[model samples]
Target: MDETVQKSCWGVTAKAVIGLAGVILLAWLVIGSESAAMIAQR
Candidate 1:
């Protein structure tokens, strides 16, 4: 029982980490594109 609970907890943590990483990656891509556009305009 305890092992099952631990496993679920780890699964949740892993999911949260993956979600946060995805958000950061998306934000980085958006910012990079915006900067690239600005540079092109200049």
Candidate 2:
């Protein structure tokens, strides 16, 4: 039972890490595009 609980916790932690990484990647892409537009306008 203890091992099962540990496995579940690890799964949750892994999912959280992946989700956070995806968010950061999306933000970077958005910011990059915005900056690119500004540069082009200038």
In candidate 1, stretches whose alpha carbon ends up further than 4 angstroms from where it belongs are none
Worst lDDT window (10 residues) for model 1? 1-10
Summed backbone clashes in each candidate are 0, 0
* Prediction RMSDs, each to the true structure: 0.4, 0.5
Worst 10 residues of 2 by lDDT: 1-10
Candidate 1: RMSD to truth: 0.4
**TM agreement with the true structure for every prediction:** 0.97, 0.95
Question: Candidate 2's error at 23, in angstroms?
Answer: 0.4
Off by over 4 Å in 2: none
